[model samples]
Target: MPPDLAIAHDFPLASCNTFGIDARARCYVRIASVAELAAALADPRLAGMPRLLLGGGSNIVLTGDFDGVVLHMAIMGREVLGEEGPDGKFTLVRAAAGENWHALVQWTLAQGLGGLENMSLIPGTVGAAPIQNIGAYGVELKDVLHSVTVYELATGRLRSMAASACRFGYRDSVFKHQDGKGLVIVDVTFALPTAWRANLGYAELAQAVAGAGLGAPGPADISEIVVAIRRRKLPDPALIGNAGSFFKNPVVSKTRCAELLAAFPALVHHAQRDGSEKLAAGWLIDQCGWKGRKLGAAGVYPKQALVLVNNGGATGAEVLALARAITDDVRQRYGVTLEPEPVFV
Candidate 1:
C-alpha cells in the first residue's frame, strides 16, 4: 500500500459504465487531485500493470473483467477564467475532467454561456469530450473547444494542447492515437462567444424549433428544442441502459454516394465539405432489418436503429455480438461498413 494508492480490489463496475455490463476491476482507485494521481502512478504495485482512465463511463462497453488498475476520474470544478476579448465578446470557461458533461451544459446555460447549447443532454464527462470530440445537432465540441489539460502518465508531466493539436475528427481526437497513450485528460477550457447565435442548421433541430412556433430562436430556445428532440430519439440510460448512438455515420466517397443514391433514391445522406458523404447509419441499420431486433438480452432500440440497448442484464460480449451481426448485415446489404461509436473494453 503506497501513500498515494487508495486501492480497492475487485471493484464492481456495472454502474460505472452506461451499458450496465457487470464487469469488475482487479484494482481500482478514484482520483480527485493531481497529487493523488501522481502518487498512484508512482506506486510500484501498479508500475507494470495496465491502466484504464474512466470518466463517466458513458462511452464504453466492458466486455469482460479488467485485469489492471481502474483510475476513476473524480476531479471536479468549474470556473470562469475571464469575460474579455476584443470589445469583450468572449467568455472563457474551464471545467475539471470529472464534471458531468450535461450538468456543465446546464450550468453554462444558467450562467448565460451560449456555445454548448446545441450539445445539450449529451452524456459523459468533460475529459471524455476531447477524446471522442462529441457532437450533436449541427455543432461539434471542436467548434467551441479552446484547449485541454492532460496528465501524462508515461512521463509524469502535465501538458496543455490547443484545439488544433487535438486532431479532432468525426468522433475522434489525438487522445485516440497511440502517441497519446498514458495521457489522462484533467480539465477542458472552452472559449464561448458572449454574443450568442443559435445553430439551427441540422434539419431535425431546425424543424423542431420551428414547430414550437419560435420564428427567432435564441440559445435557450434552441437548447430546449435539441433536448426535446434527443429525448424523443434517444432512450434514457437509467431506464433502458443504452449508450446513445451505437454506430458512427459512415462516410463514403462522392462516387460511392452517387452509386448508392442511384440504387436507392430514398437513401439518406449528408454531403461533407470534403466531397465525402455521411450516410445515415440508423437508416442503414433499419434497412438491414436490425431495428428492434434482438439476440439474447442485447437488442436494437425500437425507435432508433442506431442504438443498441441492454434489454435486461446484457453482457458486453452479447452486445458486441449483436453489434457484429448488424454490422455484417449492413455491409452485406448496403455495401457500407458500420463502425461502432462506443469503446469496446
Candidate 2:
C-alpha cells in the first residue's frame, strides 16, 4: 500500500449498501485520487484476492460477507469540457465518480442544462450510471453521455471510451461484460445541448407536467415533478433500507405478451420500439401476492411492489431469500424471468 493510502481491515459495511445488509470486507480502502487507485491496484497483498469496486453502494446487494478488498471510490471533481455545435449550442460537463448522481443533475439544472431532468431522483454515482445504462422516464444516460474515464485494473492504465463504444442496452453496457471487467470508472462526461427541450414522452410525467399547468416546463420544473413522483412511489432508502426497483421490467415477445393480455386483461405493459412488450415486474410481483409480504426481516414495500425493503434488522441472506422466492413465484406464474437490477455480491 502507498504510504498515504487509507486502508481498513475487516471494515464493517452494514451502512454502506442501500439495502443495509450487515456485511464486512476482509480489507477495505478509500480511493480518493488516481494515484491512490493506482497504488491500490498495484498492491501485492490485494493482487490475488477478489476485488469489489463500490460507488455510492446504491445499486448493489451483499448476499454475504465479502472476503476481499473493497475499494470505495471517493474521487471528486467536475468541469465544463467546452462548448460545441452551431453557435456553441452544446456544452460538455464532467463529474467525478464519487459525486452524488442526483447532485450532478441538480447542478446541471442550476446551470440551465435540461437533458438530465427526466432522470432526477435516481440513486448511485455517475460512474455507475453508464455501466447499467441507467434510464428513467424517456431518457437514458446514453442520450447525454459523451464519454467515461476508467482505470484498467488489469493493466494499471487509464483510458477513455466514447458513449458509442460503451455498447449500451436496456439496463446494461460494456462495463458489465467480461471484456470490460477489472475496469474502475473514475468519472463520466455528458454532452448537454444548450437548446433545452422537455422530454414528456412518458405518460405519467407528461400528465404530471400538464396537471401542474405547465404546458412547456423548464428543466427545473421537470426535475421537481420527477422528484415528487419518485418520493410518492418509492421509499426513501435512508428512511427504509431498500434498493429502488428490485427487478428490471421483463421484456417478452409480442406473441407471448398478447397471449398473456388475453388471459389477464388487467396486465400493464409498454410496447417497445422493437415491437416487443415490456411487462411491469412490479405488477407481476403484486399479482403473485408479494406486496407488503414478509420473510423474516425482509419484505416488499407496501406502496411499490417493485421495491424490496429491509424491515428492521434484515440480514443479507434474508433479503436474498425474499428476492429468490418472489423471482420463483413470478417465473412460475408468467413464464417470464425476472432479472434483478442490483449487482449481487
| Per-prediction TM-score to the true structure, in the order listed | 0.97, 0.97
Tens digit of per-residue lDDT, candidate 1, span 1-345: 335568999999988988888899999999998878998888887787788989989999999999999999999999989876798778999999999999999899898889999999999999899999999999999999989998887788899998999999999988899987667999999999988888888888888887899988777888888888889989999899889998999999999999999999999999999999999999999998888989999999999999999999999999999999999998988899999999998
The per-prediction tally of clashing pairs is: 0, 0
- Please identify model 1 stretches exceeding 4 Å from their true place: 1-4
C-alpha RMSD between model 2 and the true structure: 1.3
lDDT of each: 0.91, 0.91
Model 1 root mean square deviation, Cα atoms? 1.4
Least well predicted 10-residue stretch by lDDT in candidate 2: 1-10
